[model samples]
Target: MQTGNLLPLVLALAVLAYGLAYMRSRAVAAPLGGIRHLKSLPFYYAARASLWCGLPALIVLALWVAFEGKVIQGLVVSSLPSDLMPESEGQASLILSQISNVAAGKLDPQFVPPEIAQAGSLLENLRNQSQTFKAVLVLLVAVLGAAFAWSRVAPNINARESVETTLRRIFFVCAAVAVLTTVGIVFSVIFETIRFFGMVSFWDFVFGTSWSPQTALRADQVGADGSFGMIPLFTGTLLISAIALLVAVPVGLLSAIYLSEYASKRIRATVKPALELLAGVPTVVYGFFAALTVAPFIRDLAEAIGLEASSQSALAAGLVMGIMIIPFVSSLSDDVINAVPQNLRDGSLAMGATQSETMKNVIFPAALPGIMGGILLAASRAIGETMIVVMAAGLAANLTANPLESVTTVTVQIVTLLVGDQEFDSAKTLAAFALGMMLFVVTLLLNVLALKIVRKYREQYD
Candidate 1:
């Protein structure tokens, strides 16, 4: 009876109707008819009938769910006594909730006046009416769809081909939706970054040496000039990512080699998921570990070695990030290496090459394309990592290669720029978008290059 509950009831009825239609279609025609009677089978007819009966009703239910709250609120606001209505938006929402509760008989009558009571009754009636209308509409659509499907169903209808074509279209639409969503996100980042560039010169942001971002809030305030140099941030990002890759690539790649080429199946089944546990660990936890454990350890080691090291060193953050990326590289690379044909390894072995030799010379070369793909993917992840850098790497944007010094990364800068208070139109907030766009472009390029390399190598192996 309630509008909130109508969608589920309608879906249930639609499913029930589909089941009945399917049964009727099947009863009328056996799955395999005499050689002259059918093109495909009876189940295909049932499936077609069921899909037609249920899909349209489900679509309508989805639309009603998406917009019903807005429609109900508009109706309620138009019917309300202006004097009794709450002034603030927050208060209005609370009032609406109270009114809904009253209509549902969940609220006491003493809290509401006679006029409010009449309004509650009207709301209840409206809700019931709306639900009835939706259910009837859905039922009518389902019946119409079923009737159309039934009319099309005959001894000679190519139901299998029709179902396959429909399914293919659905899958293609899903793929398009996914691709469009990614493109939309990239465009949004680009547009906002362009707005930011309009406020700050592209050359200054990219090439300037200084990195301060604090600025005065008002136009009349003095000393509001903010520096927006990105060179230092980008340098820091590269340094950290390089260090992480250095740490992760060797360990990850070797582990992948062992798993793919040498480890027993029993060992692999146990070790693979255990290694994936590294990926599952929260970045925030890694952040604290880097800040508390790794940073201090690096600082102490630097002091012992007669070198000055900042407590919050870029090395510490990068090291932890590397550990974090290991599973990503190892898991992906292992799978790629395993996918290489066994014949390549066997051919080398048959020529009196040792197992290690075959793995190193034959399997490794054959799998290089996929391995590069994994490393590129891992590099992109390292570039995008945020939490560990924010917590461990100091905010100062230093353009030095010395890993012991405090430094910042693009992701860290973005977090610092947007964290607390921000005006959407300010250069400071907009800079985050620019940084994001740069990051996106870099990752996209890496992926494209990796794919190209993989494809070329794959052709050679084939």
Candidate 2:
């Protein structure tokens, strides 16, 4: 059966199991002068039975779904004649694609060899048979588990313990899955980065000034040698991020202070959510704003001021990105400022300090750690942003600190490297992974620093 269809059926079976076990629990308790005589509640008994009916079936179904394609493909490949067998993984993949295409009627039968046609037929048959067996196995397991749970429903059975243990294990499994997924992503990037390093020297990538990643397909092509220098990309990233932080930090921090410290309840309530709506605006919209409006305006302004500015400049992207991240800083800082002990503020005021004085001397210092954390988080968001940089900050890896000039960020270059039809083995494509690894490292360091600052200051307050 299809997974979607099987899931609903399994859910229905679990519901049935719950009902049956609940009735049995009530019936068993009736003879002992009420449900109080039972070791656990009827709800616990119902939950335990539902879990028993669902978990085993779901586990079997998941495993079967995960491995069925690989198993069937292996079987199909093995059935091919030795002379027709694939010699490499790539060849095997191509054969599988052809078989799949033929099975799906996307390929003409007469266009391929008879052996391939026969293999496609076999593939179809195996898929059908596999689905049928999977359905049967899942149903049987659900029934057996439900039956066992039904039999175990007695006055002395501690269904609560069983249910709690199962839930705890499920939670642990979820945590493990999340951790493993992160590990998998990191290792995948690491391996690809290693491949990239093999093609391009690490020192050249890190320190070289040029940023062109275009490699000629033929030896006769001009400028065939691609430069993988990341210095310019990183410089642009930091330059833009600095401009964004310069705009965001002061404005957001001030707004947060006003809302949390000085504003009345009505004003705070009116302004906070409206300000936070900036965060909900789609980044693409921000990109459009930066590209269509901000970039042109900045160029015109710069020209009026007797300075040159690119039509697409870091200033434009940074300003818009700063505006976008304002809510992040404001909301977080406001909450942190509000979390400072009321007694601290009251004590400061009673000691004849002005509101501003109290805020500076007590509240601001107390909330500094959390506010710094918020700023760092906003900095990370600004650094990692792609759309605004792409649309407004032109993709020129100019190693300049001038915000008025066109420059591209690491993320922008990464996107540029991997956007279209590109071979992964090439340094151009693998450079994306290398950029990703660098970004991950940078963001990790920022987070670690933020955590340390927060912890150190948090201890003082505690």
List model 1 lDDT by residue over 192-299, tens digit each: 999999998999988887787777788677748788888898899999999999999999999999988889999999999999899999999999999999999999
Error of 2 at 354 (Å): 3.9
What C-alpha lDDT does candidate 2 achieve relative to the native structure? Answer: 0.94
> Which digits, one per residue and each the tens of the lDDT, describe model 2 over residues 336-440?
999999999999999999999999989998999989989988998999999999999989999998899999999988888888899998888999999999889
The residue pairs that clash in candidate 2, if any, are none
Best by lDDT: 2
On the 0 to 100 scale, the lDDT of residue 203 in model 1 is: 96
